[model samples]
Target: SNNDYNYTVDLSDKSLILISINYTVSETLEIPSTYLGRQVKNLSSSIFVTTDTSNVKTLILPDSLTTLDNTNIKPIYTLENLVIGNGITEIPDSFANYMNNLENVKLGNNVTKIGKNAFCGCARLKEIKVSDSVKYIDDYAFIGCSFNKVLIGKNVEYIGDEAFGYFDYILSNKGNSNILNPYYVINGYSSTAAEKYAKENGIKFIDLNNQPADTEQTYTYINDLVAGDINLDNKVDVNDVTLLQNYSACNVEFNDFQYKNSAVTHYITSITINNVTEIQRYLSGYIDTLEIYSVG
Candidate 1:
């Protein structure tokens, strides 16, 4: 059923985005998946926030969703459950910052990044699962949170400052913690970034890999190629740029991996080399892939 809401599309991409919704909304809602015959892929910060509508107890996202803008996520005063669809690649900046009463979050498996302040100040959040594909978690993303259990995937490469740590307010106010398991304990594999982070912050760590491997989503790859390495040369150079240019112009077809990977790789390496134009070109291609939701 289509919940009453308004939207605006990105003219250049035909991507759907929700702009507003009426205040008279149901307590539990399944946000409409389509608008104007196109699948809605991006959600604005206010679309389902508790500040905008306090009646929302659960917000079910669409599988078409790829982006959730959290730059201005007002507190979810009453929202207890949130479902992130599998197409989503990242939870954008401030996605759930200051949602002081949130209790549960169902993150998608495809998500790779958790933006800055994504879940900051969620004091009542008791459990969260960082999907296996996630690689980055930004600064203050979970500041002041008092989660009882947090399972970080093996793929995680970085965790930013003040994330999942004692925030200024948390320290001063002396919040509640799991009594039997007092300090924070990140459920992750030993020697992984999660373990390192836990060690540095005096947080506890639990080894997840000791369990049956088949039962878990293993993202730790023994051999991984760097992005933008089109030629498999282990470096992003002018030849890679030329290859991308040729591929875009339809002068070449991919013999390496897929064009999407090549394009994304090109996009990542361009930033280091200061190739602004090439970076923008490849970045657009990469973003286009993510926006398509179910890319065929």
Candidate 2:
């Protein structure tokens, strides 16, 4: 039987796992957070085969879920966007196999491991920001895909070979026809796996640690700002606090403009967790001003 959200569910160990959607037509599919007073925890691998999902353009998996089971998550051919919620820790192997039209994906902040061949054959996925919480990315996790820009976090302990690039097939179809993208760029910190991988694979590595030289014009731009305004919305508040926390956790990366704003603590070089604390103190009214440190 279908639940209120038209999802077929199975109750296991007092939690609900979605079996499939029973609907005939739905454009955007949002996995229900709760069903019959129990939290929905998983999506059956056969979910896509149970119903017509060709019309679904977006899929939002909520934070209440913890697992996307092993085996290929049968494709939703027309799916263009996918949002994975924060409760999930691992993405099963071959999870999104052959999703050719998939363009954008937002991974949850808590995702720790990306299983083997998890995104195999997703040729249209252009960019992905792997959260700081991810440590292990298994072999061939991103093989057979097209990714031009990837923002890997600081805590990634291991990156499986060919995870983000497959040289001969991943070419730049935009600017110069003969140019390749797999060797273009990878934005990450210095002396990390992200840099090592880029170097070994012939990709251009942009070390987040080594930002552009601060010019006279840059310092002038820095002096005219509130120190804790990491997002630069012209105010220092709780939102800046959250952005600082995310930046500290390596969940988000900042541009030069935001980086200057975040260097509020007394660091000799870069932004650190101390800045987050400083922002908190300022918000609590424990301190009056945020000292803008001169960072090189």
Candidate 3:
């Protein structure tokens, strides 16, 4: 073990496998590409499964790592940044699932497959751009997450059920789980798996080949602002709900009064797809009135 970091390893005839890291290492763990004379190729199946990983905020897998050894049994709550190296081809099942604070990820160009529930329940993730080298995305790979945009690559061939564009289950009505639909837009090529998935799930899709041009708008707030009346149309309806969804996905912007009206949860800064659900509930007679949380 001639490496600077303290980590136990198992040596094979040609490569080295990382067993476990000493708890005293830095928060940013950049696994060594080589140890002594052998390529560091693998991590133990139970790597990061312990409570010792509470301090690791940033993790960078080495370029020599070609495979994972069943390490996705649990989530690393503290990990805020991740970088998958170029040699890895598959993202393992439940990789980084439920990581509450994870904000960024850099997937390698060699990655071809994303396994089931790979990034599920990561609410803070604002956007993700899948690389063109990826071809398969397994079920629930990115479900239970909210984002402004998801850019699927053109080469993706198969996308599993609820793999993208769905948010977490926020309400349970009469013993039935009510999952909130995503407000983000999915960007991909026409006639590809991205388009197919977006159509099947009723998510907004933008074709990169035939994208619409951006237009400038002069937004003005009405004197008497009504809650959920996003367009200042004097009445709340499904169109306001659509506008709120678009605003959450970055497809549209809102003026100050419109932003105040969009706050259904009583907190303007906490607006999310759940706010969309509130509007839907009000429209369906499930709720009597929309709560006005931000009254200026």
Which one wins on lDDT? Answer: 3
> Which model, 2 or 3, shows the larger lDDT?
3
Clashes of 1: 3
RMSD of 1: 20.7
Which scores higher on lDDT, 1 or 2?
2
Tens-place lDDT per residue, model 3, 102-161, is 878888889999999899888766556688999999998987665646778889999998
Estimate TM-scores for all models: 0.60, 0.62, 0.67
lDDT tens string, model 2, 65-161?
8877732345677889999999889988878867878878899999999998888767777667887899889877876565556778888878887
Model 3, global lDDT: 0.72
Clashes of 2: 0
Report lDDT (Cα) of residue 128, candidate 1.
Answer: 69
**Candidate 1: stretches off by over 4 Å:** 1-3, 44-52, 70-76, 170-182, 211-296
**lDDT tens string, model 1, 1-296?**
26456777879788878866754667776766787788888777666443355677777787888767542435446788888788888888878777765777888879999999888767677666776799999887877566545788888999887676444231111122111213455788777778888887767677887853222322211024344555656665667777666666668765322232343432322222323244445545643321101111
RMSD of each: 20.7, 17.9, 9.5
Error of 3 at 124 (Å): 1.2
Tell me the whole-model lDDT of each prediction, alpha carbons only: 0.62, 0.70, 0.72
Residue pairs in clash, model 3: none
Q: Which prediction has the highest TM-score against the true structure?
A: 3
Model 2 global lDDT (CA atoms, 0 to 1): 0.70
